[model samples]
Target: MTHTTLVTSIQESTGKTAITLALGLLAQDGDETVGYMKPKGTRLQSNVGKTLDEDPMLAREVLGTDAEMHQMEPVVYSPTFIEQAIRGREDPDELREIVAEQFEALAADTDHMFVEGGGSLTTGGIIELTDDEIAELIDARVVLVATYEQPGDVDDVLAAADRLGDRLDGVVFNLVGEGDHDELENDVVPFLEGRGVPVHGIVPRKQDLAGVTVGDLADELAAEVVTDVPTDEFVERFSVGAMGADEALRHFRRTRDAAVITGGDRSDIHTAALEAPGIKCLILTGGHRPPGAVVGKAADKGVPILLVRTDTLTTVDRAEEVVRSGRTRDAETVEAMRELLADHADVEGLLGH
Candidate 1:
């Protein structure tokens, strides 16, 4: 019999995909065949003239699964679908049937199957396909991934526990900071376990794991890459060069693998960014082309220069959004995730071993 684990998160950007993929990897390492599916697709993307969810595509690439994309993502929650459901034109029973059929087909030949939830546990509630509802539909165990930023964040986990009840096999805390680790272990974990909630893992926050490539930032902002340097470098964080050149130099020096955002005409800041250590890319705003000297310097230093039409503030906002929406595209990030889970998470407990 195939064991299905539904991995959902309390809120958005809580590392659900990362944890799900890591679990699948662990299962695969144990000589078990694994499959993955996302019942409701929210992160829409167009590929080869077909609209599909991004998560399943990433899973197929990572796991080398043989299932087609449509089988992996049975229903996509597009704008039209959401509108129909809200208008009572779409039948929830029919949607649930579709999801069940796909789930069965994928589980037929695998020892373990991972069903990733939408942005949150309550996602698709309008259509009666929330994470808990889907878990009941597929007879799967639930694993919630939560982000621990403060003491009060435990309330969300408790709430989820109340909702999921016995179906919740465990919870994994992802992206936890170093300073909060002690409190989580001593106080929060014990408190939750006392309430009959299982804390499976506590993953520390790593800058490389949360980073985005310079190319990803450029694509999100629709910026123009003016230089010929490679844009594939991973940017751990972004710095705004709004201050004086000297101050910006000091700030840039403090950051590693960072993208510096400044006005294109600010040649002083541009030059300083190139000279500073760990400056991976320069995002120039206001559509102003940097001076020839600045471009030449950036090119010589192997840093890509991106020109954006928006102001610095808007550009920074878009860049921040890109970084916040982390992707597990590269092998290094996947390896790091595996190591973190191996050291911190109880994979056997999560798998009911």
Candidate 2:
């Protein structure tokens, strides 16, 4: 029998994908024949006239899994499919069987299979395909990834343990603030262990791991690149340049490797952003073109400027989503994640060694 592990999270944007990728890489390093699958894909991308899940495609690229794209991601949560399921036109048993068949096919050739779940444990509950349901279906162990924002976040892990029961292998706490590390290690971990929840890892918040590239932001906002500079630079944060020139500069100075979003007509803000330190990219909104001097200066500074037709608020919202949903595409970020996992996470325990 193949050893199967299902990696899910308490909620969205909790570095679930990063954790999954790191664990897969660690397993491969151990000379284990590893396979990957995402039973239900929430994010859709078009490739070769077929809509596929984005995460599984990334897995194929990074992990070099031999499975075809369709097999890697068996079901996509498209609008039509969701509507049909909600209207009682889709059969839950049939969908579950399809997922199980795909799982068995992939597990046939591998010693270990890493199954990635949706954004949360309850993501596919509407169609009867939640994380716990799939875990039971495939007889896979469950590892819950939860972001530790406050002391009460442990409640979410306890609830997940209750739902998963004996299948709950452990929990990984991600994006933990630096100051709270001692508290989590000293207090939270022991408390959870007492409650029958194993603490597998406590990964601190890393800016590089959480950052999205300028190209990713452009794709998310559908913006036009006005500058010829490279868009591969990582944007660790973002600042809104709606204030006066001096105020904007002061605000921009506080952040490093950030994207500045403001009205394109705000040449004053644009000039201030270019003058300020750590501005990686300029996102000009409202379709208004910037002055030639501002564009020339940005180009000279090697900062890419993105032009979008959306308003400042909308652009900011989309940019935030990109950062939260960012993938582990960069080599440095992946290496950093591997190191963090090695130091903090129990790789052997997670892989059932």
Candidate 3:
């Protein structure tokens, strides 16, 4: 069977999921069938006291696959398991076995599999099994997504490249702060190249990712939206806290066409967000019922409301997916991103193209 795997490493909260999704979209531009996997995940949700390492829904979204979430991300080991394993109650090797099994499954039916790593290069309290181990296990090339602002990020990238040995493909310098393009091309690129690490691509900081459907954001955050506004317009910008009228007004002004995603139960926040001037919409997360008065006020103000049961971070994750995918430019930036990958990537060796 012919298969290619693209593994990405990113620091926590650096838009790794966005990049994974973009790569999946790009790979699909050709005739290639793609799959996705998150090899290491620390967050776990318990179902009937059984812990799952990853949120399967995330894998489904990133991979754009119909395969069951469990099948896509099978090597799940929660922090509890890690702690237990450390105490000798659970076999540490069991997690590795699970990941290997899933990698085998993903490899079986796809032309290319995009494997995403959890957190950054060293996360999950298991310093022993760096992302390098997963890359080695899957026999896949590694693409490092280095967050731009870290002071010693270059060192981290270089070290990761060194550890990947032959498996290291390239590095994508992501999350460039807005208006830092000059420093990136002149300073960052040349420095990395001088050290022999090929700079694959650089993703600019985009504000549009804040524009995501209110309902989708609620779904991820597991929250609820509680207004009559068009769910679509509720896309982008979420702030959690006292949803007072003042805060709502400020957020609406500070963010471009943003929605205040908060809890409906908090009448103060709900009412405040509704009253914000030119507010796009108000999303009530946490699945709480919005007070009737708040609902009426929202209607009067012509703002929409949605309800979901997820926390703040999950809400951000879903909203991010919407924003990142909503306004993609197949322009010079994307082409530049691809060129960097092709230049450093061992494409001929990995995919035989």
Best by lDDT: 1
Candidate 2: RMSD to truth: 3.6
Q: What would the TM-scores of all predictions be?
A: 0.82, 0.83, 0.61
Error of 2 at 234 (Å): 4.4
Give the Cα-based TM-score of candidate 1 against the true structure.
0.82
The C-alpha local distance difference test score for the whole of candidate 2 amounts to 0.86
Instruction: Point out the worst 10-residue segment of candidate 2 by lDDT.
Output: 326-335
Per-prediction RMSD in angstroms?
Answer: 4.0, 3.6, 6.9
Model 3, range 1-353, lDDT digits (tens) per residue? 54545555655655566566556656777778988777665445676765554434555654468775566666455666577667777554776677788778877888888877776776534534567777776777777777667546667777777767777667776657656667777887898889777776676654444245555555555544555456555454455645456765676566556666665567776665655564566656666778788788877777767666765566656666555544332233334444444544443433434
Candidate 1 lDDT at 254 equals 85
Instruction: Name the top TM-score candidate.
Output: 2
lDDT of 1 by residue, 78-176 (tens): 888899899999899999999999999999999999999988999999999999999999999999999888999999999999999889999999999
Prediction 2 TM-score vs. true: 0.83
Q: Kindly give the number of clashing pairs for every candidate.
A: 0, 0, 26
Q: Which of candidates 2 and 3 is the stronger one according to lDDT? A: 2
Sort by TM-score, best first: what order?
Answer: 2, 1, 3
lDDT of each model, Cα atoms only? 0.89, 0.86, 0.62
